[model samples]
Target chain A: MAIVVVNVMPKPEILDPQGKAVTNAGKRLGHEGFSVRQGKRFEIEVGEVTPTVLEEVRHFAETLLANTVIESFEVCS
Target chain B: MRVGVVTFPGSLDDADARRAISLTGGEPVELWHASDDLRGVDAVILPGGFSYGDYLRCGAIARFAPVMDQIITRANQGLPVLGICNGFQILCEARLLPGALIRNQVQTFTALDQPLRVESTRTAWTSAYWEGQTITIVLKNGEGNYQADPDTIAQLEDEGRVVFRYLGNPNGSLNDIAGITNQRGNVVGLMPHPEHNVDPTITANLDGRPLFTSLADYLLGATC
Candidate 1:
């Protein structure tokens, strides 16, 4: 079986409150000058990795896994 | 008039929406997410709550439910539809309405009786209220912040499609928008739970009663 990973992140223009909260916590913990942005990762299990499979997964990521209006997704094998 | 309230898994306010419709002298029909049938209702309401456990994203999974197919088809055909809270999110995801609802800017789930001004009374759902009328309704949710592209925002403003604007600008919504309608004014989506404020016995105010009454008035006038 092959696995493909898709990562989704909030668009830069959209607010990422969770990421900001985490960054604030890091600051409280004495980690300064570093920032973090949060996103979601999805791993899809497939019988085999092929061009068609990759395309299909990309479609899934775009249509289901991520809302394109506020987020962007990347498909990785 | 008959108003249908769709109930998806984890929906908490479907009953309240139905009750509100009934109180407004309209028949209430219950629609299920797993069914494609709309039961021939004159209007449909998508109520608040976490559907499909709010998985992936709020209203994202519910947008693909079987019932949504029927709702989308009917809504595009000029059927009056109202989406509240999570329902608003579903409407955006279904592209029935412009913009997406994101997490509150403060990163907290906010619940309050929010003050809002009627921006436009041209929509099927807001015709009972006069333009610029200020009213208060129950606002409760985590992802209630509304956002859209600059062009879409401009178009909405230019067209006077903004239905409701928050008087106090809670949750950091763009232009203080609490609700909006489509170009045809048949479909509207808002983050506040108007159904929760319809009954004065249960709630302290009846500010939401006008929303249901407005739909009833529209349907009655349409049939006349």
Candidate 2:
């Protein structure tokens, strides 16, 4: 079995209210000259890693793991 | 006419949707998310709430429910389907509708009586209203902001498929689009809850009554 990790984030063009609010709070707390973007990370445990399994994971990532309209996802091995 | 209202486990507005249909003189059939059967209802309503506990993104998980698979098949066959608020989110997630709904621009949940103009009367749900008519309905959601690529927006505009446009920007939706219909006009998704405004006893006005009545009329017309 292999572990698959995926990261999902709001598209850069879209307004991310959560990220902005966090940036503001950081500024208030004296963390200066830095910004943060919030996103999600999912770790999955699957059977043997093969090209076919990887392709299936990619399909699921595009269609279900992330909504391409406003968000993007990246699959990491 | 009979309208089916499907209730996801956390649906908050299923009862309201059912009541709206009953008040409009249509039989209301209740369907469950786990069930694959549609019970042969003429139309369907996916009422609003935090389905699947709003986990992994709003409507993301609910879109894969067993019932939604059948809903998608029937919707493609031209069954009249309406998705409100969280239901709208689910529709987008399911790819039954275009675009996506993200967090509100204000970074908080917004709840208000949102005013909107009927942009088109060509849809199965908005046929009772004349073009350019204005009405108010309840809009409430944490992730109500709608987004889509520019080309898709142009297509929706060029086709005159936008069903409702906000009178004022409530959640920073692009083009002020409060509601939209698919190319076939059989499916619609909107952020506002028309069901909340259907009964005068619950609300002061009945701006939403027309939507239910419109469907009832359309179904009756189809049978004749």
Candidate 3:
């Protein structure tokens, strides 16, 4: 079995209110000099790890897992 | 005409949508999210709610439901579909519409009887209203802020696809767009709940009834 991981993040230009709020809360809690950007991670286990399967998974990640209009996604093996 | 109101597990306004359809002289049909059948309805309404508990992003998981597959199919074939609030999110996630609804810029859930201006009435759902007509509808959602690429905003504006614009820019949407229609004009997604204001018993003014009546007329006219 092969595990495919995808990270979906808000585009850099889009405002992430949750991440900003968390950043503010973190500063209040005494953390300093750093920022956080929130995102989603999904791990899928596939029965077979053929090149065709990987390509298909990439298509799914692009079309279903992430909306490219305001977000971008990365696939990690 | 029969209007199908889809009931996702967490849909809060399906009944209201059904009632609105009835008040506008159309038959209301209940459709299940887990089933692919549309019951051969003339149109479909994805009512507002936190479907799939809004997990992993709003409408992210629900967009893959079996019913959505068929909805997308029929929508491509010119089915009139209206997505309200969370339904709007689903439409965006399904890529039927062109933008994403993030959290409100103020980071708070906004609830109000907001005024909106009908920017265009060429859509299947807005033909009953005159251009520039103003109406009041219920708006309540945490993730109602709309965002898209600049080019997409220009395209939407150029194509005259923006059907509704907020009079007072409540949620910080780009171009104050409260609602937009697909290129074909048959599918629409909006951040307000028109169904909630369709009846006089619920709302003092029946501003939302025209939206339903518009759809009813469009479908009936198509058959005649």
For each candidate in turn, the TM-score is 0.98, 0.97, 0.93
Candidate 2 vs 3: which has more TM-score:
2
TM-score on B-chain, cand. 3: 0.98
Residue B147, model 2: lDDT of 86
A-chain TM-score, model 3 = 0.91
lDDT of 1 by residue, B1-224 (tens): 88999999999999999999888889999999999999999999999999999999999999999999989999999899999999999999999999999989978999999999999999899998999899999999999999998899999999999999999987989999999999999999999998988786897899998889898778878889
Location of the lowest summed lDDT over 10 successive residues in candidate 2 chain B: B214-223
Pairs with steric clashes in candidate 2: none
- C-alpha local distance difference test of each model: 0.93, 0.90, 0.91
The DockQ value obtained for model 1 is 0.87
lDDT rank, highest first? 1, 3, 2
- Candidate 2: TM-score? 0.97
Enumerate the chain B TM-scores of all models: 0.98, 0.98, 0.98
Q: Identify the runs in model 1 with alpha carbons over 4 angstroms from their true place.
A: none
Residue B128 accuracy (lDDT) in model 3: 92
Could you give the CAPRI-style class of model 3?
A: medium
Report the lDDT tens digits of candidate 1 across residue range A1-77: 99999999999988888899999999999999878889999999998999999999999998999999999999999
